[model samples]
Target chain A: MATQASLDNPPQVPSQTSSTGRGFPTGLAVLTGFTGVMLLAASYMVFVYAPMERTLGNVQRIFYFHVASAWAGALAFLVALVAGIVFLINGKMQWDRVGKSSVEVGLMLLTITLTSGPIWGQYAWGNPWPAWDPKLTSAAVTWLSYAAYLMLRQGIDDPRRRARFAAIYVIIAFTSVIFTYVGVRFVEQTIHPHVVGPSASTGEGDFGVSARIGQTLGFSLLTFTAVYATLLAHRLRLENLSERIKQVKSAVLARQG
Target chain B: MTDRVEAETAQSTRRTLKPTPLAQATLAIAWKDLRSELRRRELVAAMLVFALLSLLIFSFALEVDARSRAANAAGILWVTLVFAGTLGLGRSLGRERDQGSLEGVLLAPIDRSALYFGKLIGNFLFMIIVAVIIIGPLSVLFGISLFTPLLPLILLLGILGYAGVGTLVASLAAYTRGREILMPILLLPIALSILIPAVRATRAVLEGAAYSDITIWLNLLLATNVVYIVLAYLLFDFIVSE
Candidate 1:
């Protein structure tokens, strides 16, 4: 029944010759261009438009986007988690595809977080992965768990079962992620203090950001949210199109009978 | 499982012939399953052999001297059972599946939960037998009194929780394509939360720790089992239907 349904509605990949936004001059091109522009503006604001931290100096500025990207990745995973539940409920393949898109974005964003975080860590504070600081390890484990989720799906031939298993894994992975994140603070006293501010730990770490800088950070989050949506839509279309091609080829093969 | 099926057929025949006079079906089903497993012993023998081999491997691999081996013995025992138990579980489910017997059971008039519970009980008892065999040799090897009251209690709870989760996972993995590899891969992480606390509780009990000292660990084990049983109950239908 599922095979027949898949055959009936072939995926629709746009027949465009080049990578473009619905036949426009650019797809990734526009994204890169906007990112370049935002980067330039952000750099200007970061050094000149926003004030620096009194205690940590220039390094604190990295928090504006580092934390933003991490936060965004976490948000994406949450969406993926919820979407996984929805996909399981109705057997909607589209929901599963969207869930995968969010996961990919989350992975990419987490990679950025991991990369940028250490650099920021090196400059501001010394040492990395001091303890089983559940925060850092959880993120890495969440990433690994999802990678394994993909591997699990890859091993299965049946699409419906694959989606179901994948959904179950996401739920399990999401639970672990929460456990890792939420359980960390109580278990260990680490150098990585709460971000919301001045305390016995990284003193005045939160005090550096002014109102204008906070506003700038908010705008950066908004921009990335837009970028996430744009990329998600593009990825989903690509998935839909590939599915169509598969259907078409299978149909053609059947007709060749 | 075979006995249960036989009993079910007998009861159904009586139903067709005599109706309400022969309506005691549930106990007959349970009795059949228990008697068949008691006779065949295939699952128990495999689990026991696999568990002993794990202990042997661990003893050789660790190179821990006599002094430390006793302390590490509890960990070694649990780890061996958890892993080698996978083999027993996969074989147990895969055999039923291969023989087309699973369908017969599914076709029988019984609650799905009854079938699940029957499998769980059978698997749990098999694990306990393996643990008993393991305890004898492990005691000789580690020079620890594993037959002590507390140790048996710990073993029973640990084996119960482990096999409970293991049976459900095995049933699901039976239907998956790459049954052998996928079973362990899927089972290990999801079962990690449960196994950790069980092993921990056992370690605490073995170290002459008071029950109060290990209460949290045991509670964690109990809580995890309850959660997984509920989840497995809800989700087993999906795997069976598939």
Candidate 2:
């Protein structure tokens, strides 16, 4: 019955080959193009159109990309969490693939956020890295948690067990991300600027953005969301191809024996 | 024939009794672990010695003066507990995995949540015992009375939260290749949410803060404990399920 079901719905392999003939799906291709164009437009607006901050000077421009990356990273992890829960509910391999791809992409983007954050800190606060800064600390912890997720995946041998455990783990690990997102409010003394929420700390340069800055920031956020979708779709395809290769390798070995 | 039928009815009634109550099943598993640990005496002894060694190392490393020691005592206490608790959790679960008893426990008729509560209770007891033993030596060394009535209450809540999450993560880590190192890596980040409030509350209690002043920290600790316990209970069956 299982074999018949699988045969009835054959896997759809994309035909629009990118030089190597392992074709990128048309939807992914369109997404890649859209993301690239939007990213260029966002960068142009951020650098040329947005006004300079009176307090922090030109270096504050990094905030647009930095915050955009952080938002994208958070959204990616949120997708992973949803995928993980769905995988747990139905035991679907596709959901596992989505979860794994999103985590990898999210980790990459979060690493960018963590690095850019310190540079912004150095320009704004005279210190490159401030210990006990709540958002930064929480981000570090979230990064470590998902990094451990990847490491956990590496340690398990059986693919099914690995998928199951990873799905469960990502669901739990996402709490750290939630905590990082809102934990700053509950924490007593954070130096991170409260851009969206009410300012809790008495730190300098925690002001609201002007109209032009908001426009640029909004554009950047939208562009990065597209970028995240593009990356996730490509990563999912890579996972599918790898899985197919593994199946083919085993089949060939059986035939040879 | 009537006597035989009555006897048969009694046998069927006995056989049809519900499986052990949740609380009883939980305690039974906990008791089994406790009795086994009592026989071996390895987990608690190792945890105590490690905690004391951590204390000694902290004193030497910090070059803590009497005044400094009093000020930093809460941080010292929690750091010690976190490491020692991690050690004890890893060893306890590692033994179960190695002995193949985890499988036996899983195969038993009780619900997986019962097994979880059992291990949680066992772990919480071991942590409290280690904390109790260390508090005395720490008090003598630091020259501050660490034995406030509020202290144990805080420790209980903190360790309950810790063990609740730690047991689940330890079980997950036990199945991994780097089983020994993975528990702390997986556990410490989650435990921080609990430990932060715990350390703050412990400090407030030790410093004799007003009841109102310490209430928030205590509430945070209680909230985290409840969250972790519920999360572990919900997710553990999925984790251990084949």
Candidate 3:
């Protein structure tokens, strides 16, 4: 076994079963919390101080947190995809858990993003139910793909084989979102207009900001990023525990044999 | 420590052993599957009959007016092909797996990807034949001119992509516990990118859209097929390894 003192040296993988736990540090924690406080302040600044849009009104205010949640979810998805690649390369069961947990968390945030988007849609676009909206359609598909990922996992029994297959499968599903998101850009001219009422699709390019609103929006985004990191830390730990339990159970069975 | 190095060495040795070339192995396995299915003729007959029935039902439910016929002919035809094609896919792999030929093929020296391609080709051929049968009388009944060149190209590309993806999805479904229900749930969404382009290109061809209008859809369809083929090959080894 590797020495504890030498762990401070190069390339040492801190064991998962170590009593003190494996990831993150005290200073990092304090800093992340501080940054999170700063972000919360930013959210307040945006909603309270940011000037309302002349057309879309206060409903457009959700764009800051809205975009941030969506951003973090997309970012988490990329991380999960990377985790999947790592799982495939290493064939380690832990990476599979990381992939699964990250996806679950990502799905939660994406659900918020999807829900919040339509609510924002109803207030700002004058119609909450636009079937042809690319974002809505694409997000629905992305959500479904992850749901499909869950089903794929449920279908397999062997941990290693399941990890390997899910790794490959998720990577394939993830890329189509990129295609779908951008597919409209190519055909933007022909897209179905906001048929139910007035058009709010014109907002993609409409970014002008009051100073207070800007700072608040910026802070809200920061807050969520910190929140995303914190949630991920909690999830990874839970996964590590379940994994340890599995290994310990198997080990006991083997020793009994 | 000693066990790890020994296992690694053994795995390395396995890697260096000669494996069959992809094309020759693919053609050989496909030929084998086609020959077996040809001898039985059961899958083809069932799929053809199923395709006809689906068309008939659609005609009745749709209340097939001439205007509706003009607009819906392509969509109905493709939808019929899609539904009928699933039976061919499910039954083809389902039978192979059930009969124990699956293991015999796995035991062969050839790479497992060869099996994927071979099955895909067999499925593609069956779909094309079914399309021909479904089109002839359905076209007469519906007053559709399904005889154009662009239409054939659209059909061929759509079938190739669908069959290619379907072959792998079917294999995975065969191994998964719920072979019947799990297929469409898994296949349709994964197959969506391909399906969208397939529908668009087929519709464009039928609607007499400008070639330029249809070109991008065709290219995207082609890319979808290529990506699925490569991904399916990468996945075939894992899905079939056990």
User: Residue A229's C-alpha lDDT in candidate 1?
Assistant: 63
Candidate 2 per-residue C-alpha lDDT over A143-176 given as tens digits, one digit per residue, 9 for 90 to 100: 9989999888998998888998898788778864
Report the number of the highest-TM-score candidate.
2
Model 3: chain B TM-score vs. truth? 0.88
Q: Please report, in order, the local distance difference test score of every candidate based on alpha carbons.
A: 0.67, 0.81, 0.73
Give per-residue CA lDDT, model 1, range A1-257, as digits (tens): 65566557644543423333244336555775776677677667767777767777888777777776887788888988988889878988777787888888888888877877777767656764444454666666777766666666677788888777677667766764664465443433455646653344542234545788887777667656655666666677677666666665766555544
Better of 2 and 3 by lDDT: 2
Model 1 chain B: worst 10 consecutive residues (lDDT sum): B17-26
For candidate 1, the docking band is acceptable
Q: Which one is best on DockQ?
A: 2
Checking candidate 2 for backbone clashes, the offending pairs are none
Docking class of 3: acceptable
Give DockQ: model 3.
Answer: 0.41
DockQ of each: 0.23, 0.49, 0.41
Quote the positional error of residue A168 for candidate 3 in Å: 1.4
Ten residues in sequence with the least summed lDDT for candidate 1 chain A = A13-22
| Residue-wise C-alpha lDDT for candidate 3, range A1-257, written one tens digit per residue | 23433333423333564445556667557866886786667666656767777767788777777777887788778888999888877777778888888888888888888888777777655666575556577778888888877887888887777787778777777766765656643543323233223445554425456676666666677777776777787787777867776665555445444
